[model samples]
Target: MMRREFLRGTFGVAGASLLSEVATGLSGGGAVVAAPKSKITGGTIDLREFHRMRRFADLSMGRIAYVERGKGPVALFLHGFPLNGYQWRGALERLSPYRRCIAADFMGLGYSEVPENADISIPAQADMLAALLDHLKIDEVDLVANDSGGLTAQLFVARHGSRVRSLLLTNCDVDENSPPPAFLPVIQLGHQPGAADKFIAPQVADKNFARTDKGLGIAYTHPAQLTDEAIDCYFGPLVSSPARKEQFSRFLLALEPNLLVPIRSQLKEFRKPVHIVWATDDIFFGVEWAEWLDRTLPGSRGVRRVEGAKLFFPEEMPDVIAEEAKALWGVSRSPGGSL
Candidate 1:
């Protein structure tokens, strides 16, 4: 079935709204720049399409791999740690018709190739994003992020608030919530030698293991439904080589010392429209954090709680993200198209 038809069938008209035409001046910049529309509009995106469309931007840090689709204003998608741009594949597919969605792999993760000594800290990741945007000639974006990506998004707002038009954050770090106590065990393991080989390699080697509590399964609402292809795409690169494993370990260790604490003042000062979506069942980030964000951000639109959803719920339930993103972007359905 066509992507639009399939989404419409799955979520009624609300889903089809994702593909409808958007207003020309939604970004608050001048008119939205036009780009070629997608030719293929059917079927789900797979590993093959991911590889075929992947592009790279060489910066001072290293090679950053990313995928871009859609047209009009840009919406930058940030993925969680231990995962990459593939996490937002569903969001990219669904929202492409309305926005130029770009999902980039952070350094030391996914397809982004960085030096062995590269600093993969959260702040550094935010800097890389700024450089990436500059390279792409994108002046502003609607930020959509999850997990550590949310943390990075906050830092991005703190340092480069002018470049952001809006933000949509899912279950992630906030203020003292950075490196939540529940994540200490993983950080400890990451600090150990050969952590990736011991903890990460096994998950990639045994796809079923990834669906268990011992692996990625702990974060997803429906781990059993996670495909083998996704396992390879998400975990394969983490343990691809000794350097990659070390980089992955460094990424976890860098999360310490609570980077978001100092940014509270900046968050309070930010006046851009913000939305916080939290997963109730997520043990790492509770609903209180979302409430905290709503109170902290002056322009916060408020929080949307997802009952029983886990940390990675955004990956499984892209429709919810689409709905929230459309609402945040001031997109409304009309007989002519979207406004």
Candidate 2:
């Protein structure tokens, strides 16, 4: 059925008539019920088409789940911990007009499969990304990363500087000594046998700020804007499979005791044009860390904030991110660039 017809049948004046017609048609071995096309939000773009989308490539780890769309210079996105590439849906929509935005579910998150007994360290994740790029025949691309993915992106650029054209980092843990207090327990637990899994499992559903409940207001600037459906989308993957929670637990454990040692010595020399986009009210990785990052990375651009945005700025202010990315790409802002 056509999209308008489908919508009309599902939620329009002829709802009952359409349902009866569809049921009778199906019963009589006629046309099958056609699913409605997923609608795009903000009249921007349809995100359902991108979730767990696949690419034909043979990397060491096999098929990976990534969403690649638009057509221009390639812009690669890596999401933070406890979240998947789905977090980039809004940003992707805004930037798609000017770039071929590719967002991937890092191994063990979203639809990507984590290898059993594989190294879950930041360096290992960087290597995986490199291999995937080689397999896909992508020589270089602009890199945008958030949270732990920022750390991973930095490591990747440090290891493969030639492959990175530019960098955009947001609210990520950059300083080794400044790990969030909320994550401290997880770090400590990883040192103990079987402690990692136990700690992360319960906290997955707590809905409290990772650092402190007090920061929830800052993290979620507009808490009322959040809906049950949105929360479900964000948290569903954590509980989607029995192995997901365990795998995530292992990944977080692998990150403890500092995951940046492999690339620490090289970060000071990473002179790529880097932009530090941060939220002023971030609770997890505070704004102070952004200053440290700017000072440490030579010639790094200073910090910029999304007014009233939280740690999850990609979701909260995708347009702001898109505008920043567009400026980085040296393009004029498009109609959808403003949040």
Which candidate number would show the highest TM-score if scored against the true structure?
1
Task: State the lDDT of candidate 2 residue by residue for 115-220, as single tens digits.
Answer: 5555666777888888878876788889999988887888887889899988998888775643565456445544555432354333345444322322122344
Off by over 4 Å in 1: 1-43, 334-338
List residue ranges in candidate 2 displaced over 4 A.
Answer: 1-47, 52-58, 188-218, 335-339
lDDT of 1 by residue, 3-24 (tens): 3332232212332221222112
TM-scores of all predicted structures: 0.86, 0.75
Task: Assess candidate 2 and give its TM-score to the true structure.
Answer: 0.75
Candidates' RMSD to native: 11.9, 16.4
Against the reference, the lDDT scores of all candidates come to 0.80, 0.63
lDDT of 2 at 170: 86
